[model samples]
Target: MAATAAGLTGSLLLPAAQAAKPARPLVIAHRGASALRPEHTLAAYAKAIADGADFIEPDLVSTKDGVPVARHEAFLSETTDVAKRPEFASRHVRKTIDGVTHDGWFVEDFTLAELKTLRTIERIPQSRPGSARYDGMFQVPTLEEVIDFLAAQSATVGRTIGLIPELKHSTYFARLGLPLEERVIATLAAHEYTRRAPVEIQSFEVANLRMLREKLGKRANLRLVQLVGVGPVKPSDVAATGGSLTYADMATPAGLRAIAEYADVFAPPTRALIPLKKDGRLDTPTALAADARAAGLRLVTWTFRPENRFLAADFRDGAGDDARNEAGSIAEMRRYLALGLDGFFTDDPALGVKALAG
Candidate 1:
C-alpha cells in the first residue's frame, strides 16, 4: 500500500476519540469514471464506485422547474445530445453564466421532464473515444435519484460511499430564481442515505458555503470544501457582490485560515500544488499542502486523467498526447500523493485506486 502522506499522517495522530480511524488519502471520482463513461449518469457513478472511489462528484445545475441535476455546466451543448434533437432546437440561445456568454441550450430553460429526454454524451469525444461509445445511453439523473442510487450501491458494496457535490454557478443560478444551496440541502436531507453519508459540499464561490455553514452548523457526516481555482478570477458570488477577492487571495495562509471557519477541506487544481515548467514537465512544488495543513485544513487537489495529453512531461510516453497512458497517469498521481495530500479527484477511479494500492 502507498504510505500515508506526512501532512495527513500527523492528522491521523489526533486522539482516537477526536478522530475516526485513519482516512487514507481519498480517491474521489471526478464526474464518475468520466474518462471512460459519459459523465454524470448512473452508469458512470456505478463504475466509479466499483473502481474503489471513496466519493463520486456530481456538479449540480438547475432545471426550469428548479430541480438540481448533475452537469458540468448549465450549457447543454457539450455534454448532452440536446443539439441533435429537433424538438428542442428552439431551446438553443445565448446566455451568460458567470460572465461567459455561451450559445447553447441552458439547463435553467428545461424542466425535469424535458431534461429527462436528453441523454448524456462524452464532452470530448476525440480524447475519450471509449466514453463516446456510451454517449446517449444514459439519462440525466436528479440529485434525489443520485442519492437513491448511491444508497443502493453503498449497501451492495459494504462500505460507506461518499458524495462530493459541487454547487455550480451559485450566483448565476440564484439570480434566476433557481437557487442551488437550499435545494441541495433539502435533497440531501430528504435522502436517508445522504443524511448520514459523508457528504462534502464544494463550490467555487464564497458566500454560499458561508451561508450553508450558518444554516447547517456542523454535522459529523457533513463537510464543506472550498475549491480554489487558478489565477486571479474572483468567485462568482464575490463578483456579484462587487467584492475584489480573488481565488489567489483565498489560497493564502490568512484566507485558508478563514476558510477553516466554514470548510473542512481546501482543494486546488493539481498544478497549483506542483506547477508545470515552461516545458510542461513537473516543476518545484508550492507550499500549498503544508500551508493548508498549517491553517488546519486538509488539502485536496483536482483531476488526474489517464491520457498522455493531460499528464505532466515527466510521466508522458512518446505516444501522442491524446492516447490513454494509464501508467503515466498512475505515476503522476503517486507523485502528488507523496506530497502529503489528504485526497484528490481523478477522471478514472480505477487508476486512482491502483495508484493508492501501490
Candidate 2:
C-alpha cells in the first residue's frame, strides 16, 4: 500500500513520538526534492518536506567573503547566471583545481551580495526539463537562512525535518582561512542542533571529519560522515585531481574502522553498495553493509533516482530506464533496509517514503 499523505494522516502515518525513535533507513532528500525543483533552493527544500522526506541534504560552499552558502560547487558557471552577467566578466579567472585548470566564475571570487544577483539553474537540464522553469528564480542561500527556514518549517508542519550538510572542499575553504568545520559547527550550534536536534555533517576527506570531531569537542553530539566514491585517489588527491573521495579507503575494513573512530556514518556511492552488472542488473550488497557494521558504522548510500535504475535493477533485462525504474527502486530500498542501513539519499522522496515503510 502507498504511504499516507503527510498532512492527511500525519499522526497515524508516523506517530509524533516516533520521530524520536532511532531512524530506520531514512529517505533523505538530496538537495531537497531535486527531481521536482532546482536543487538547494528554498522551493526545492519546501517540496521535499511536503513530499515526505525525513531529511534535506545540502552541500555547503563558501563565497568570496567566506560566508557559508548552500551550493554543490565552488564555481557558479554550470548552475548559476554568473557566467552570463556582463558586469562580472572581469571576475572570471583560470585556476588549476583538483588537477584541471578551470576558467570560470568561481564562488570565492564573488561576495554574498554579488552572488545574490545571480539566480540558480538546473544542474542537469537533459534529465529534467521541468526544473529549467525555475532557472533564475532563486539566489544563493546562506546556510543560516536555510537552517532558520527549516526550523520554522518543522514547527509549522508538526513534523521533524533533519539536516545533512556537507562541508564541500574543506581543504580549499581552510586555505582561504575560513575553516569550514568551525563555520558549520557554529551555525548548527546556534540553531541548538549540534547534538540536541537531528543533524549530521559529511565530508569527502578523512582529515576534515577528524577536524570536526576534534573541534566540535567530544561532548558535541554532531555525527560525522565520510562520502566515498569509485575513484582511486584518497582525500589527498581530491584537491589535486578533483576526483571523488576514493573507494580505496571505503572498501577496506580498516578504512571503515578508522572512519567509525570519528564518523557515525559512511555514505558510499550506490555503486559501492550494489554493483551493477554489464547488463545493468544489481548484484547483492551484503558484503559492503556487513563490513561497515563490523566497524560499528552505519551505511548511507546516495543519489538513488529513477534515472539511475541500472544500479537498483533486480532483473538483467528490463523496460526503459524510467519505466523499469520504479520496481528497481522498491527492490533496492528493501534490500538496503534488510542490510540495516541508517539512511539513503534520493531525488524522489514520495517513492522513497513509500519504500521506507512499504
Candidate 3:
C-alpha cells in the first residue's frame, strides 16, 4: 500500500499506515537473478520473483517488426546461439552503431520469425556457468509480452510485481527511424501500464528524456527516470566534448537541474552518490544527490550488489561473495534508503522487500 506524493507522477511511497514499517532497501534483480539465469527470460524473471525480488528489470530493444523486446545487446551474437546458424551467416553484416563499428547479427536485421528460431546464451561466461544450460530455451520476449507477464505475475503473486525497463541505445534506435518514446507509451497504454501500474521507464540519454517530456505531456502519469553516471569531466566540459561523450555531464548540479525539469527520479550508481577514498570507507554522500533532491527530483541509486560493497573498509570483505545474505544486504540498503530515496533498483529485490517489511 504505497501512498502517492505531491508533484509525483507515479506512486513510490508505501501507505502512511505502512510508512512506519521497518524495511530494508529494495533488491531489484538486475536481470532476473541474472547472476544465475540468462538475462531477460521468463525463467530469470520467475526465479527473481521466487527469490524475493520486488521488481524485475528488463533492458529493452526492438524486433525486426518494430516490436519492443527484452534484450541487452541489439545483436544476438553475445547472448544467443545466432552464430551457430549457417543460414544467418550471410545475414551477419557489419554496421557502425553507438559510435562503434560492430559486425554481427543485428536484431533489426532479423524478423521475429527468424529470431524465434534462435536460442539465447550466456552473455558473460566467466562469471556464470549455470546460465549456459538455458541456452536456446526461451525466445527473445517482446516488451508487450513482458508487460503482459508483469500483469499476470502481479495477479499470481497477490502483490504488484513492478517492472523497470531501461531504454538501451535509444539514440541508435531513434536514428533507425523508430522513436522509442512513442512505441513505449503505446505499449504501456495498450497494456494499461501507465502511472497507475507498477512500471517505470528509464533512459541514459538526456535528449531521450526531453523527448519523453514532450511525448508524455506535462502531467503524464508515468514516472520518468534520468539515468546518469559519475565521471571525471565537468558538466560544461563534457557537453562541449559532445556526441556520445561519457555521462560526466550528469554529475554536476547544473546538469542535474536540467534533468529535474522533466524527470521525477535521478538514478546513478551507488558509488557515485557515495564515493570512497583510498583509506577505504566512503567520503560523505556527494552533493549530487542533494542537488537532485533540491531540484525536486527523487534520488534513486542502485545495483547495490554485494560485489560492490567492497568500499566499506571495516565491513567484512567476504560478504561480497554471499549474494543471498538477506540480513546483511538489508542493512546496507538501509544506509541508502534512509537518505530519503524515492525508490531503488536492485538485482535482489527480496532484500529490499524484506528490509521494507521489517
Q: Which structure among the candidates has the greatest lDDT?
A: 1
TM-score of each candidate structure, all chains considered together:
0.94, 0.85, 0.80
- Residue-level lDDT tens digits of model 1 in 66-158: 999999889989999999999999888998888899998989999999999999999989999989999879999998899899999999999
The local distance difference test score of each candidate is 0.88, 0.74, 0.67
Candidate 2 off by > 4 Å: 1-21, 193-195, 217-221, 237-246, 308-328
Q: Which of the two candidates, 1 or 3, achieves a greater TM-score against the reference?
A: 1
Better of 1 and 2 by TM-score: 1
lDDT of 2: 0.74
Q: What is the RMSD, in Å, between candidate 2 and the native fold over all Cα?
A: 8.1
Give me the candidate number with maximum TM-score: 1
Compute the lDDT for candidate 1. 0.88
On residues 269-336, what C-alpha lDDT tens digit does candidate 2 reach at each position?
77777777776666666478889889988778887775543344463235554343555666666666
**What shift in Å separates residue 146 of candidate 3 from its native position after superposition?**
0.6
What tens digits encode model 3's per-residue C-alpha lDDT throughout 1-358?
1222222323322221211211443456787777678888887888888777766888887776766778875877988888999998998888875555778889887877888788778786554556767877887777777777877777787876667788877767766776566666566655544444555578876776676666444442345678875675322223434744456666677767777777777888887777777877657777776888787776778765433342255343454443234455667667766676767766555556666665
- Order of the predicted models by lDDT, top scorer first: 1, 2, 3
